[model samples]
Target: MNLETTSSWFLMAAFVLYCAAFIGFVLAVTGRRWADRSPEQHQRKWGWVSFGISAAGFGAHLAFFFTRWAAAGRIPTSNMFEFMTFLAMMTTAAFLIIYALYRSPVLGAFAMPVGFVLLAYAAVFPQEISPLIPALQSHWLMIHVTTAAAGEAFFAVGFAAGLMYLLRVVNFKPTTSGGRAQVFFVELTIFTVLAIVGFVGTVFTFKGAGYEAVFLQEKSSVDQKGQLTTTEETVTYTMPPIVKPYNSEMVRMTPFLGMKEPLFETPSWMNGVNAGRKLNTVVWSLLTAAIMYAALRLILRKPIGAAIQPALDGMDPEDLDEISYRAIAIGFPVFSLGGLVFAMIWAHKAWGRFWGWDPKETWAFITWLFYTIYLHLRLSRGWLGRRSAWMAVIGFVVVMFTLVGVNLVIAGLHSYAGV
Candidate 1:
């Protein structure tokens, strides 16, 4: 097989292994929860087996990453598809490190699914290799994006640990308002997870459906007098048009819904085709979430979190809380060094300026600031337990927005994020 095809096979193989790992981790958690004390030893055995499966998957994932890098003739960090795959791999790596330190099969139960979902999500994006853009053609691209993804992977581990801590700490009955809020968040997490998985399934199922939307795209050309002039033209897209160049006249079409309207521009700072696609993708996620929620309710007859809550009983919430906190503490400096410091240096080298406040840059900075606050609040301000866990969870959200949302929702100087 050629490089792209070969890399794809490796990627598919890795995903299959991830699926097996996910199954193993799930069994590890559920088996321990329901087993008698005598069978508890069996739980330990299952946990080791689960760890082995994920470790093997990690090896496969690593190979898949390098194959893509070789095919691209550069580090695979230039687009959403590439970075998502890289991020998933890093998250797996982070989980393995944490397991080595903490020896918690529980973390694997939560963390491996995050990586698998991300890998599945990455599959939805077009994966064709392309020539590097001028701004992205630098060795610094590898240094900056790879490091940032590594930091986010640590943050992902923190999120999974924080999530487990919350599930353990939150009262299942939730008679009080604060307790109710925690329960809502737990349910929201379930919703979001199922929705993301559904998104991958739904997007691919309808991949060839030709869901077209039109936009008025603005254009500029030099006039006969050697002056610049701007013009608008109607354009159509097979997906949602989130952001676009200035003054594009896009006509919106959704025959399935029997809706058509004039598509307007997003804020000049934010408008782009990818932005609309991201929004549309969210709609699909929600739809899938609702359907899955209904089916789950029919089968289990309760909120999904309620089913998992018993499995969390007697687990050390404090340990999970600390692990989550420590992961972020470790990740923050790495993020700052790569996402901010190296990013600025690369930007100055590539664009002749260091701090343009592009949308992606702004979000990255916002993410950094949020995590900094999380650290300060916990380390110095005495936050702990549920509050600290929640902070870690929110901090990871900021990281996700930096990694995924900014690329999809905003048009910025960092244009390499989109295909």
Candidate 2:
């Protein structure tokens, strides 16, 4: 098979393995009773099996990336889909590194799911050949994009850990009976259910609705050859119809009245710009609002326990929190050097400017700032445990914007790969 075809197969395999790993991780966490009843030999065997599966998936991802690079005759960091693939790979690599140090399988529970989502989203875009523009042809493209993505991957892991920390803090009492454990389990279930429903709602509302074209008319009077002539110009707006209720794609498109030509037949560049604008204004706003609402709810919820308590019978909250901090610290310098400095250097060489305030660049800066603040808060103000955890969670939003939102929702010069 051609390299592109091989890469596709590899990605497919990686996605399947990631899904299986996620299931295994969840089983390890929630099915503790079964593990407890099993022999020690059985637990050790399953742990090795889980790690092997994850490692195999990571290896497949690496092959997929390298094959794509070979096929393209250049690096595969130009577009959203490629960027996401890189991000998934980085997350796996970072998780493995952290696991080597801490031996915490709990982290896999979140990392695997996040990685799966990223790879799945990467599949949305067309996997055809991506012709390199002159600006993206430099060697710096590889270093800049890869390192930045690696840093973001670490932050992604931090986000998962922070979330788990929050759940552990708000619901469970470390020293008490199973009351806290029950609460933690219930909260996790609720979060899972809501995530599923929201995903279904978004998919049905957005993707299920087919594309439509809208038009506007403008009239102007002008003097032509000593006579007054009235002219009417029609402007066209094209997008998928908006779904009203959850998962409803039955919205009717407005009839196309008098117009010079169809709106959507304009070049692919114009289509991308238009779609980017719509996503920036409409979709992003709703997402921001939803996130703010969730944050507020989390803040208002009373903590069921005070002071740092063991996450589980033998797990110390301080150790988990420290690991989280270390993860953030390691990720920050990588982000600074890779996402900001290297990217700026590459941008200067390619686009004749160090910083263009392009959407991708802007979001990368945002991600850097978020983490900078996170580090600052952790050190200067001595914000550890829950506060630090919250910052870590917020940092993921910035990372997500940098990784996915900029490509999907914002128009810029880096709009080569299919998002």
Candidate 3:
């Protein structure tokens, strides 16, 4: 087979291996009660086994990366699919490093699912390797994107560790208002993860079923000579349309669940060809997440957080807190180098300015500042345990918004990366 096809197979293999590693990790954490095996021995044996599988998966992932780069004649991070997969790979690398130091199977239980979600999210985007645009042809593209994604991957690991810390420490059965508030936020965090899973599941389900909708959007713009130009752009949707693009006519729509057409038009202020489609995807994700959550509630007959608390009974909360802090500490300087320093250098070469305050640039700055505050508060202000964990969780949210939300919700020079 060609290198491109081989790369695809390797990526698929890496994904399968990662899934298997997650199962192994889960077994390591939860299989202590198995007959005839000492709990410590069982966990130790399975932890090493799971870590081996994870390391092998990371090897496969690297093979896919380099092979695809060779086949494409460029780094494979030019678009959403390549970038997201790279992020997933980097997250695995970070997890492996942290796991080596800590030898904690619980970390694997949390971190592998994160890698799973990122890889699945990458699959939602187009996978074709296209030539770089003029603006993206510089070596800085490799330096800047890869390094920044690497930094973010460490932050992802920090988030996973932080989340595990919270799950271990939070009081599920609350007596006071503060305890209840903590429960709410923790559950909300879990719900957000489920929402992302719902999104990936929903996209793939409809895509595999061949569901489609199409629209013709009329866009009005002013030319340099002050002439008004109206253009028609075709917007396609792979999921049934809950809403159509603003000021657009439907070309065709496949019926879904007794809905023949979009239920409403996108708001005129949304202001992008695919804005309506993105909004619809968000709606569907939330809907699916709710359904899944409700089903889980029925099956477990308790709040998801309460149900999960038992699995973490023997974990050391302090160790989890330390791992979360250490991961973020390592990621902080890396992020500063790549997201700020290298980005500024690339901006100067490409756009003749280092600080344009573009949406992506602005958000990247915000994310860096947020992490800076996190480190400062933890070190100088005595924020530890619950407080530090919350900061780690919130920090990843900022990183993700900078990476994904800024592209989808706002337009700027880096919008090309969104595709």
C-alpha RMSD for every candidate:
3.5, 8.8, 1.1
TM-score of candidate 2 on Cα atoms, chains taken together: 0.72
TM-score of every candidate: 0.88, 0.72, 0.98
Full-model lDDT, candidate 2: 0.65
Task: Give the lDDT ranking, best first.
Answer: 3, 1, 2
> Among all windows of ten consecutive residues in candidate 1, which has the lowest summed lDDT?
236-245
Per-candidate Cα lDDT values, in order, are 0.79, 0.65, 0.91
Off by over 4 Å in 1: 33-37, 208-270
Candidate 2 local lDDT, residue 165: 72
Off by over 4 Å in 3: none
lDDT of 3 by residue, 1-419 (tens): 99999999999999999999999999998998773688888999999999999999999999999999999999999898999999999999999999999999989999999997899999999898899988788999999988899899999999999999999999988899999999999989989999999999999999999989999999898999999999998999999888788889999999998999998887777653267788788788999999998999899998898887777888899999999999999988998999999999999999999899998899999999999999999899999999999999999999888877776577688888776
Which of the two, 1 or 2, has more lDDT?
1
Please identify which of the two predictions, 1 or 3, would achieve the higher lDDT against the true structure.
Answer: 3
For model 1, what is the error of residue 166's alpha carbon versus the real structure, in angstroms, after optimal superposition? 0.7
In the range 232-342, model 1's lDDT, one tens digit per residue, is 766545544333334555455665543454334445554544555565666667888899989998998877878877877657888898899888887889889889999
